[model samples]
Target: MHTLSNAPLRTVVWSTGGVGSIAIDAIARRPDLELAGVWVHSPEKVGRDAGELAGGEPLGVTATDDADALIALQPDCVVYAASGPDRDGGAVPDYLRLLAAGINVVSTSSTSLVYPPAYYSPDWRDQLQEAATSGLASFYASGIFPGFGSDQLALLLTTQSKKIDVITVTEIALNDHYPVADVMMDGMGFGRPLDFEPMLKTPGFIEMAWKAPIHLIADGLGVEVTEVRGTLDRRVTHRDIEVAFGTIPAGTCGAVRTRAAGVVNGREAVVVEHIIRMARDVGPDWPTSEFDATYRVDVSGDPDIHCAMNLGAAEGHGAGRAAMAATAMRVVNAVPYVVAAPAGLLSSLDMPNTLPRYAFE
Candidate 1:
């Protein structure tokens, strides 16, 4: 671990679209981390000021698509919120370049990058491990639901019990779109047979994207995943509405479900399920249909424990903007730690305890 110092860390963000905007806002508000520049994927945004694009106060830095420009800035750390899970292949090469140039990276790419062999490219893993040998400075990738909620929460729950038998984590997103149907035949397993654009509204895709989350938790908790299975469902409604692309039938729902069992010494000990519903054919009300994302964590041991959290964009903090800020903050916080660890692929679980990485102040 690197020694703590009085000087604030120098950093830059590597994104310019969708969720990237949220991270940029968080960087502007944080005092301990400095936003050195911005990188946008859209060619049209290349010359615009970062603030105008992100809707924040102008810091004089303009958005650019050029990686060399970001490298020339001599940043101490790099916050990687650019490419999402599906686009990981496009982003890994850049990350490798950053590591070779001695810059640290943190990403929210494919879930399997947080684990090994279960879903990731073993060759890529080997490459990153080799890069780690270059120095302690490393790379990290996280899964939103599985990485933070399922895996981290499971770890936190274990602190409460000496004897543990089963751990389960479930996440349900009511209105958000997941593309399960489009990818199921690709071996993601049980999802809809919908095409790409429509698949985003499908259910099982979320579980496919998050498979590693449960796997990571089981591994971190000293257990083995013996079996992985899943299911997906859609809702039917009586109302219809016009969408930007077209019209969705009034009674329709796209859902996905997964049941994975991990066994230790021939006993099922861990189970994880991810459910997402974009349009419910039946609902409590129009408002509940428009709003409401529920999450729960249940751990069975000597004393059963559970955590049920209700989140509504009603307060303006959610998977939308708040998630952006949280994601940005996560990347910013990871910068310092990544800079000091050996490179390649790394996750929060792989972190050393003494690393002084974040300051709420």
Candidate 2:
């Protein structure tokens, strides 16, 4: 572990998108961390105040497009939130660049990095390991669904049981108020035909995105995963529905339920399931959430255990935005742990409990 300095860790936010915006706000709020720089991809966002981009009071730091300029500053850590459809392919190079430069990384992107050992690509992991080794930096990735709510929470619960059978983590979310058009329409195929294949529903995508949590839980329970498999079920709306993204025409796909499981001894011992709907009423038979989003973990074993976590915000704030804030904060909060860890890819199992530090003020 690296020694802690009395001064705040110099931190840079690597993007100004939804999650990145929240990350900026979070980093600004932390006294133990200093907001050193901000990066923006859009031409319009460049030169804007970081606080303005984050929808907060003006902070002196301005957003820049020059990655080299930010790296030259040599901040202690970077909150990486720049992500698109190609999650791993797009984020890996950025992570490599940052880690190789001795900048520890805590990211909401490339969520599969939540457990580097379980990731499908050995070559990519090797590259990351080599980079971190040379630079003496660490890389850690996590977020709401596949991060804390699933693997971490499930493993926490398992400590109580004498014997275990199956561990399942489920997320039920209503996405009507989420205003990301590209994600809803292009990436998820929310308003597309039932037969239309969305990038999210493509073969191996779910397994790639969520297998980390499944395998992580299995590893925690002293089990081996023989295979990782994904199954997707989508529901079409009977009536045209209005959403923040756009209108979902009647007969268009509006809801999706994906289950990614880790097969242990030819049976699913660990599973991560997502039930997302454009509207609450879209999937009547599916698991429901009182709030806009709910994360549930069920351990079917000697002593059955079930826990549900409901997520929401104040009256005026949209649940979607609140959820994004949670996702962003998850990584932001880990900055210190990532910066202090031994140089390499680290997982939840490799670190101590990461409590919310200095948040009361």
Candidate 3:
């Protein structure tokens, strides 16, 4: 959508998932932005007010599914919650069109993992990149995990230490209740027996997702990774556990354990451990049916330091629709910076902290 050079950000949201809804709620309470409208894929929600989907009374904005109608809104920015096929690997293209149409954008689509699409799918990278620069529009993709927990942001934040030591990040959560189909396959290591330990080198099924994130961290931290290793635990059919998927043994977890290490000039200094789920993985021996996460950072520097940090998000991954909705609104709150950011594939670490402090309620 087009915007006058001086007007406040006119933000349009493309979906009302969990995170998107939360984000919309944030925007509904903010006075700096105009909640352009809401868009959805299903017709059932087409006429409902965005406030209802979010957590408010009525903003008068109705949900619609037409992409063209959304672009016609001429919003200053767009928050995308749609992923993969819903937009047919075309959401990035839509963002480019929005920029070319003079609207900045932010999204949580996994595909936007890194802007310029070239990083994952080159189908529309240059087109979007060109528009981002020429149109002076912003386009960003971020998530609590890959977007923030991965390299370029959280990992890079450790560069201020005088000396170097070890870095370990673990994302542990109870994930036996998720029901999405697409995620069931890619995100959850389904298909194998409910009690199988996923092979680390199966070629395509390992939790190797940490490689790029760790590599990015290592490279930025001045370390050279000689090799990366990943391990996966698939729940196997057993006699002790019983669910819709049936019984599962203890030797396996529908989880992936990956570690990426880098040797720095003969001195091994970089290591990353990505513990996706612990119900049957790393923490299986500790607890079950509980939501928990911990991030550990240990660096022996000038004064030598060791810190262990944990964030619990077990109820549900905020990104799973509900989380994205909240984060989307937060993204809307960061419009100015996301727009003013340098024209390129920008990382959250590179993007200055601009959003207002989130109150812990």
1 against 2, candidate with superior lDDT: 2
Leading candidate by lDDT: 2
- Among all windows of 10 consecutive residues in model 1, the one with the lowest summed lDDT is 184-193
Cα lDDT for residue 253, candidate 2: 89
Question: What lDDT score is found at residue 314 in candidate 2?
Answer: 28
Residue 345 miss distance in model 3 (angstroms) = 3.0
Greater-TM-score candidate between 1 and 3: 1
lDDT (tens digit, per residue) of candidate 1 on 1-361: 2344666566777876545666676666667667788888878888888777887777787888888989887676776765533566877677667776666767764456666445546677676666555644567765446556667666777778777788777765553322233233233322223332343334554444556766787777777766554444334445553322233454343344445556555776766666544444343332232234545678888778887655557432453444334445555556666666654567667775322244544
Candidate 2 runs further than 4 Å off: 313-318
lDDT for every model?
0.59, 0.86, 0.57
Clash counts per candidate, in order, are: 20, 0, 29
- Checking candidate 2 for backbone clashes, the offending pairs are none
1-361 per-residue lDDT for model 2 (tens digits): 3568989999999888889988888888889999999988889999999999999988899999999999999999999998676777877888889889999988888878889998878999999999999999999888888788987888888888987778889998887876768777878889999888888877898888787888788878888999889998989999999888789999998899999888998888888899999877787898887678789999899799999987785233465887788889888888888888999999888877777778897
The runs of at least 3 residues in candidate 3 whose Cα sits more than 4 Å from the true structure, single-residue gaps closed, are 1-7, 84-90, 111-118, 122-124, 152-160, 176-179, 190-208, 222-229, 235-253, 260-272, 278-291, 298-306, 312-330, 357-361
